[model samples]
Target: MTIRTRCGAWLATLLLLASSASLQANTPDDQLIVGMNMNNLLTLDPAAMTGNEVVGMVVNLYDGLVELDPQQLTHVRPALAESWDISPDNSTLTFRLRDGVRFHSGNALTSADALWSMRRVLHLNLAQASVWKSYGFSKANVDQAIVAPDARTLVIRLPKPNDPHLVLYSLAALGSMVVLDSKTVQAHAVNNDWGNRWLTTHAAGSGPFRLDGWQAKDVLTMSRAPDYWRGAAKMQRVVFRHLQESQTLRLMMEKGDLDIASNMAIPDVRALRDDPDLSIDSVQRGTIYYLAMSMKDAHFANPKVREALRYLVDYQGINKTLMAGYGVLHQRPIQSGMPATLPDPGYRLDIARARALLAEAGYPDGFDTTLRVLADQPFLNVAIAIQSTLMQAGIRARIITGTGNQIYGAMRDRQFGLLVGRGGSGVEPHPHSSLRSLVYNPDNADSARLTNFQGWRTSFYDAQLNRMIDQALTERDAAKQQQAYFAIQQRYDQLIPALMPISQMVDSVVVNNRVQAYQPHPSATTFLRDVWKTPESLAGGTP
Candidate 1:
């Protein structure tokens, strides 16, 4: 058969599979087959998780004391611990574990398991270790910090009186403070690896679902827990197929083989915007897409030249056309809707002004520069738009593209001229979370590799900004904290660092009409807890 003919037959097979799945949904939809690009998933072990995809999957397979509020993205709500209490000094937090919760291994959930899970994260010092590090956590002091008076009572004492809001918010984060059945984990432990090897593929938690199967860079499937604490899951199983190609996702979405098309191409999303069978939903993410200048490059070292590039960026044009309504102009490290975020300065594209600035910077004939971007749209297309505008001011710009790691590794190594990156260190919806990770840098030692702090990656450091971040984080008064954050925003604008904030990221997910209550959070997390299917739709052969 020809290529097109073979492709048609392949789609026919998927449609047939989808139809077969519907035959098993007579009792409240047995499954939800989702199409996603899951190549970024690294590990199923909560402490080793780095990708949001892994976190989302593990979220269903684990539970923390607290969780992000379903409706309010910035707030927290109870999870494993039905209720909690605080000491008068604000340094001690105590939680009361819900009774009768059971792990997949039939072990009962308790405060002992909660303490063990956190200690494991600290002992391993893995991906989520920083959450504890923020509060003076150390391997030597782990036992003193977390205490379990009994199986039902868990308490944590911080070295300092930290903000309760920040503390709870940090704990609510997935992969940060999730619990594991200590007995099950330790039973499989070998040579102090803390069951990290086995837990990477297996789960030991009292959660909504239990891991059924996982294949790296391929597929991950989960079945509803037999006795979930809340109730039986709405869907019996969730199947995440690794379908990276947008064309394949689009065809599957059209054929009702996939329930949700996550990571859909902008062009495909737009084309299906008006389709009755599909629904396109979007949320303004906390990610900030920006251009960073390598301080090592002499051309970018000039202040006026850097300023000229800011004016050269056509944010409106790029957002309207190339981004296809998936980009919002956000010009600060502090994400929009944040309390201390100042009004955008609204710098318009003025070629005459850019030319004047470039001349003042001693480049009367403009200069040549390279703009590094990832080999993907939105990044590649946005870089092209920037190249077009910079040329008007005689700036000869070249675009270099590479895979995600190749480009990020270059940024980490500080070996590029200029690069456009998407970051969310400042988007924890907290000023300290944003500033410390994006703009504040106090340590520049060879031993201090704050890789999560993108500001450190750009080789930009200011002593005053460093002190300001420290003050803001420690200030207890609400008004003063807000002022400190506002002040940093103003100063960051005046002394443009290695970054030029362009726009905030907006995520688009096209789902079938059968997918109800499809709430995609600001962090780009997908939750199906409240999602249900219509009886008729569930019985239908097609989505």
Candidate 2:
């Protein structure tokens, strides 16, 4: 590992530099090879998908009604739906489907297929279901909610008014509203599985690219869709090799073996800032990295203990030195771009205050606890910084590092004490977008199994928070909505639910200088259709 890397435990990550040989063809000028950190890819079925890696890949193979701009989340543009109209009450929407759009399976895109795809989400009750269920969509009423007025017209009728922007935002989100070749999926269905299992490996959508083949822990390859709905992609082929080592990715970029390194370690990313042959792309993503204290844990069940632990976090020390330029200091669940975002309380490490709060909560001396963290840079490094700072207040946090699934799975199962995890999709730049996940969970029902809501995983329930989130989302009056958000923040700060904001993330990528028009999406979405390469990089020459 390079100097100043957060953790020394995983320095062995450098050894892969010699082992990871180039996987791309030397003269494949029309190809874009990406190096991705593919760890928790669970499924490809749009209805049953959850992980970001799988959704990002499948999104290229599928078409939704609308999609967020690749450069920002400020607007949603038409995709499969050429135009749409919303009812004045904000409960009904009618969409006009684009003509001549063809799925990879050679089926024509139709409103019926879009309706079926949506019903599949409700029937399967996957992660996307929370977005709908939260809006009163249920299994019994899902079919009723969706209607096909004609082959090219689709209508969705909501039982109650909702934020039209948020509803459209959900459609643009990962696996939220994907249109499938319904006939093909139904033909492949086994035991009425809706092709959920078959789709885990095969794909059926109308996007710029279609799946050629995929292997877990190996590589995933795609070929440009022929006569794609939008147009043929600039690159004829795209390959994502699953390599998690920072040194190997850097070596590949140096040798011109890889066209783009999709992700890299923070230390290596910072080191490449001055490299002439490379381009650094980064953006503040719609996510928050934080330390979660499970309410199930007896010690953390005390609200004062949770608040005390928050003050113990040295946010400035971590963001400036350890986290450095990769992240920024943020305190609230609402991300930077969203409306009604308040200033950070700016709480720094206060050992004296922490001790006082702990005493007031009946723990005169600080308590011992475990802080499960991902075994990687930034996360482990941040965990270490927090541990050292907590020790000043006599709070001992035993660090446990593991893969993301292992650590986050503990949070989902409510089997953890404390974990360093990231939460909130922030799909819409709305206050409720983050609040719904961070603290709005009202009941830990089976439906709450949606990992999008981390509060459910931690058994953090607040009836008032839930009501406030709903009210704020539907409130059309700007000032009243802002008031609702501000009041919600006050209550959340008081109750000390699940998580403590560590930092606002800035996702980075190291790409060859020849890679052009490569804009990073706010959600870390990789839409390579708009990306192209110059003559130099295409000819396997130096950038």
Candidate 3:
């Protein structure tokens, strides 16, 4: 039978078995299945796909040079490389490789391996620029990466002084700097490309888990790697089954079939909160939901028109009614708590102001436009509310809803005039990546490539962005970084490319109490390596 059919049958069997077992008290040794409403997984190649599903998988399967502590924000800890040294000039960095680490392919991870991997990532030109953008390496700095005499040491020479965050970006986050086994890749080259068909289904990392099997749009099964650089995973196997329907996911969670679940709909989230049998872990994440306007489109080209649309958003109302007070009203594009950038309260609702701005922009009689929305109920509700608000100012808005990828694709291609979508500054949040990916040209060639839908580019904005990046990298003084951040924020405020509504949205995961040490990361990605089934629970005791 097909994998999807097998998974479906497996789930049905589990449900049936669990129902019968529930006649008596349940035990924790049962499978800890997790449910999700994710529909955006395309590839497992870290350098190829930037969707959350791939990210979720990468967090579990791979290790970076550095990683953020799951419980804290902005703290960095070593992962692949045990330690490193930064040169006095701030241009060159040397890393001390961890000994005895082996890739899933059984090849020893040497300094040469690190160098080869870095070279591949630097040259591969994946669509996700955020991976390497922080390293002060652009198309210009690609040649700066150098290897030392011994294969155990790798060095990255920057054009100028670099921000420490650059290191975090390359080693952490969804950037393309993931190290791979070059020999294995060459030997198993499907189309002579590491990121081609073979790598898409197979994994060859030094991580704790190895890809055993994967069924597209259905289930992904990973088993513990015996030779992982760290220790082996406590659990022998992990299976990711695609349960796109929220109700099905909730039902599974209630039936004790799931160990973890994520991306629950807001109402279902509320319902789960009240269930005494389940424990829900919620965090206000960096993911922001907003309306992306096409600057190239004539209807939204005018600054006043953009301002009018921004003014009509009832952020407070949406937070109360739709989101159930779950998310915060986000203002600036680069989220709060970053080193640089001034936070603005953003545009508030003022129907009079919106009307006046529309009139001033020569749309006194209003205009007809389409607002493309995602298929999700919450996003659709927000779009409908926006449509109604626009109508108050004589603007006729047609609400269009489609699957997440379909709507997102339309927005990226600039096929839609306006789109309701979600984006973020990212885990290792930075302004350069956010600005370039969404508002400017995305430098990568993969799915994460931020297509500039508006087709808006200006030398003035470009120069300012470059200056801000230079200052952030070169300036060691706190005041100077803050000053540069303020200047960039001011420029972005005036530019006003996207209409941002909610800054940080709450993402909740329901985990069984038997699952010990299930800490959530600030970036909203879970680390399954740190999780284990409690001893008492494993011994057939109730959690």
Candidate 4:
């Protein structure tokens, strides 16, 4: 049979299987399936993966030094390393490896493994630059990870005395510092590309779960590792199916075919909240939804045009209408809850002010412009709202929709005048990653230099960011550190590189009552290690 015919047959089989699967209570222990609305898996390689879905899947299969508690923002507990100590001078951090931990290949983890893993992150190739830069490690210092006399001890030497957050950077490096079998990596060193080739499809971690099988853009299946350091995971198997649309996911959840579903549409989320049979988990995430303008675009170069466009936005109205009151209107890049030295300086929606600014910029009647947006329904709705708002202010704005990846690529290359996108940091939040990627030159500057979308470059802002980074490294006073962060936020507010609509986005997770200990984090990611099924609930418990 042809390849297309074979694929078609497989799809038919999946449909039939899905139909027959029992999503209701009293389902057998081995038949439970968790449905999720995840898009295409960008990459299986932890180093190369960037999307939240892919990272979430990988998180279950890999172990890091510290893990975040979903309920508390500041709390971090041990995962791979049982305990650690920092030198008084703050130049050295020593981690003691957890005993009895073994990789998927049955190799015991040692200090050498941790050293190799962190060093590789520091020297990450082009394919993994996005993940690596988030660790706040300079290339020179990363090359200096050293092992102590004890085989179980791993020490990282800093160039200078830094702060606790800098050390915490290691814990929250996300896909960057995942420990790998040192022997296997060395054996394959001569023939493999560490970041792109070997690690992309194959993983050897000491996490509770192991990668059993993976099919691109389809399903990724993992099973509990029997010899996991913390003991065998309670759930025998975990499957992640890449169902892209919200409607299909909701349908599956309603039919009792999925035990958990995330990223629900706003309307669907509201419905799920009222559903008697489902328990909905919702959290306001620390992600910013904003419109990015290409600084290199001549039309946006005029400060008056930029200010007018900012004024033309009605963030409150968009939050109320599109988000169904689920979003918080944000004024600055930094969200409100974050401990910073300054408060948010909110924006104003003044039609008269916008028109005046446009007139002053030599366009009393406004001008024509195009804004690229994601083809997703909610994002499109937002784009349409923005377009209408701008038109009302005499600016002729058109919305062009495409896949998220396509729009992001165009925006990065400065090929689009304006684009609506989201920006965020992981559990260990930091601004350097976005600063380096969005503001600085692209990875390969000699070829096609990626210009900062807002063309914003001020020595003042740069100095503030630098000071914050250095203070985050060595400062011990919590209040003082927050002051520095506040200053950084104030600088960002002044620059207005991007108009932030919402400080936080609402993420919803729907799960069957049978599934216990399902927790959601502000990052909109879950640590599924502690998730388990209750026997009583599985045995025909009432909804």
Candidate 5:
């Protein structure tokens, strides 16, 4: 057998060594073994990493200037930055760097490194740069807009009007702005690539842990950084094994082989609820699950048809049944619990209303269309539920399921008729975050290529809605901004947006009872420095 295959077999044998009858935890007390699917872990580069799985890992391997408190998202906490201040005009932000911090490469951390990191993000123009670009930061302007006066001080001058608090939230909540070891990355730079090629598999960071090795789609291992500014991580090492099969994870967890399991199937999570040694943490994420229609397609372009599709969704039934551990019913574009979030408009599955609207839109008998969705639950299950409801209104929707890339790829290209997907930037705990991502489409032309914004992907454009979203984000008064957001939602609903919100996303993570201080953040920036596990002998079983 090949070396990789042999290694995989050996690991599998070790994992299988543990059995339920033995009831012994196979993991070491000083190490945290995490079972998860690592398919979406494409890169370690802070500017290019996508998905929550990578976000959780990146946060531990690198330190952002600030971080939002997991319990209170609005409260920004200091990290690399000892403190910060916003100018009275809300156009400038200044941050003071903490002293004595050093990167894994032993290079001293400074505001120059921070400035270089921010500039590199825009210069690279990768996945993480999109949000910063939307805030008027560009490769050309980054040098001027973001500056460092001394080794300890960094300043940012906004290119346009924006809420400084939201900007701070972006810096804290979004892992994209995390500072990097510029000297190390530059040393590894090849072909003037800014280390993008190298950082894909390597890391130059100053967080609680240092990247030891990463084998793509197989395993990722990191050990605690002894000289971490805050302190060394409680766990000596953290091993994330690629356990794609939910059943395998469940079996391993039952045998005490895994300290934590994320992205478990809902059914599997439900089965583990009664397990005494396991605890499920249902973290409420800001992203929303929704049904999207491509306005480029003639069928969905009609306002009446879009309105008909809204009434055709069985939102209540789907949330009550299919979305048990996946999500909760949420119809508005804005996520729930936010001050600006309004009550659900109380849309129900009204086949009659849908049929009448369809007829009014010149389709007496509902036309045929394809509904694309991920080939995973509860996306597949939710798509099936939607298909059944659409059929009730004489609308024939053939369900097409595929991998995330295949499905979302078609949507990004504006080539899909209908799609069941989950997205929206609730990372900052701001209404504008959701609106900017899901509803504020500045341009609908295919050439605009604002695929980062779901609004552009679905070809859902409204100048007035865009203006309102922009105005709300820049509003100085809190109450007035909230009112503006409320008005935006009301108007968005009245316009019958092509993207229909069905539920707010919830992520369930199963953890061993012995694991302590393991709080999962809503923004996906989960810090593992303080997490510890009880000793096996003291806990009466493996931890």
Candidate 6:
């Protein structure tokens, strides 16, 4: 057969296998098929992965020391560790490992494996190492800070003064610290890379599922580990298919081919709201969407320019019209609903004010600049909106759109002028989580290379702000810490930060009613071990 004809036949086969004429859950009862955009899923290595997409996958493949309850984010649940305790001075943390757990390779899991996994993160110094390094752990002191006294005892000594509670939250919420099968991973290491390269396409974990196969930006499949310590995953197999186009995912979900679809555009999600056989799950996330200015750029270096740009954003309009399904209006650096979080500062679009500020900044007629954004929905739309408003104030902003790699790559290298993006460290359900990721820049020198921090990426530095953030993290008195956070936000605003918060993220996923026990987590650590699907005949029934 001709190549084109063969390709056509293959697509027809997939469509045929996806559904029947009746369309009452054509998927198998023991299997789950998920559709999502995999553009950001570049790696599966726990120590190297970035973005929430990879976190959801990694948690199912590897067990963390603990996990936050999906319903109550602050509540930590035991996972690999059966129990844990902290010293009186709050300088030491000790975890008791659960016995009889084995990795997919049949190797018995031990405390040494957990300690080795953390040490590997500091050694690799990749994307996942950023948060750990911020906590004072380094490649040099990891062996001393994190030690395995016995096969069942894992202890961690703080290298610096920090809230042990926040450290515990980090261990539970961030998938980067998940325990790995040290032996299996070490066996695959190449050139002393600590198995990073090989782990990109393989997994050595003790979670409920084991990776079966993966094709980058295409399809990934995992099968339930038969000897999982907790219990076998309800689904015999789970498949994640990359469906970049939102409409394709909607159609597949409507046809019963996909049990769940994530990262779909807002309009498509709205279209399926009335579907009797489908349900929408909206999970509030700690991440924030905002407009970032690069201080390295001459136009935004001035505080007046940054303040002018902040007022140029139509927060209400964008959050009401454009961010309906994606996020809610949130202005403070800290996430909303937290006790430490303050109300929105209520900055609005005022072209005249922006014009006045621009004139004061030595640009009577605003200068031209470029705005970088991902080609994906919401981001692209928000950029367009900002571009229009910027032009109104005589500031011309050209929109440059590309894939996540192309866009974020420039931001990471500090080569962008202006960018509309989403980020914050809200995974741990703590106020410091967001401030540390978004506002804390410990080192201002370029040589520091703190690319993991958005503050560093934007060249936004303030000695007092850094001091307040550091003080807040270690402050033992809850009342004093709360006041410290308030003072930090006030100072951040007065200084005209390079990054402006526009919206707090809310992730909406369309799920087939046939799927049960599937709860999406705020931290993006969705577990599938308890998720199961009803038989096809009863798929249309209420979940």
Model-by-model lDDT, in order? 0.78, 0.79, 0.66, 0.64, 0.90, 0.90
TM-score of model 5 (CA atoms):
0.95
Measured with C-alpha atoms, the lDDT of residue 1 in candidate 6 is 48
| Backbone-clash count (model 4) | 8
Instruction: Give the C-alpha miss distance for residue 243 in model 4, angstroms.
Output: 1.5
Colliding pairs, model 5: none
- Top-TM-score candidate index: 5
- How well is each residue in 190-277 modelled by candidate 6, as lDDT tens digits? 9999999999988999999988767789888787897889977889878899999999989988887789999999899999999998
lDDT (10s digit) by residue, model 1, range 62-131: 8889887646767777888899998876778899988999998889898989999988988998877765
Q: After superposition, how far is residue 262 of candidate 2 from its true place, in Å?
A: 2.2
- Each prediction's RMSD over C-alphas, in Å, is 5.6, 7.0, 4.4, 4.7, 3.3, 4.0
Worst 10 residues of 4 by lDDT: 452-461
The candidate with the higher lDDT, 4 or 5, is 5
Candidate 5, residues 1-543, lDDT tens digits: the string is 454774565455445433432555467788788999999999999999889899999999999999999999999999999999999999999999999999988899999999999999999999989899889999999999999999999999999899999899999988998899999999999998999999999899999998877889988878789788897789987889899999989998888889999989989999999999999998999899999999989999999999999999999999999999999999999999999999999999999999999999999889999999999988999999999999988889999999989999999888899999999989998888898899988888889889999999998888988898889999999999999999999999999999999999999999998899999999999999999998877854443
- What's the CA error at residue 495 for candidate 5, in Å? 0.5
> Model 6: what TM-score?
0.95
Better of 4 and 6 by lDDT: 6
Q: Candidate 6 regions off by >4 Å?
A: 1-25, 539-543
lDDT computed for candidate 1: 0.78
lDDT of 3 by residue, 338-443 (tens): 6664666656779999999999999998999889998776788888888888899988989888886688777656567777777654455555444433344323
TM-score of 4: 0.86
lDDT of 4 by residue, 1-543 (tens): 454664465455455555567444233343236666555466677666666677677777888877666677556677787888888877677888787788877788887787777666556644454434433455666666455557788887755555555446535545556677777766656444554566666567777787666667677667777778787777876777778777888887877677787766768767777778788777766566777665556767677787888888777788777866346676555444654524445566679999998899899988888888988756788888888888988888788888866887676555777777775443445443333333333233324332232223111124555555555545677776666656656665566554444435666678877787778766534677777766644465322
Model 4: residues with Cα > 4 Å off, grouped in runs: 1-27, 30-32, 126-128, 131-141, 146-149, 160-162, 185-190, 341-343, 429-474, 498-501, 536-543
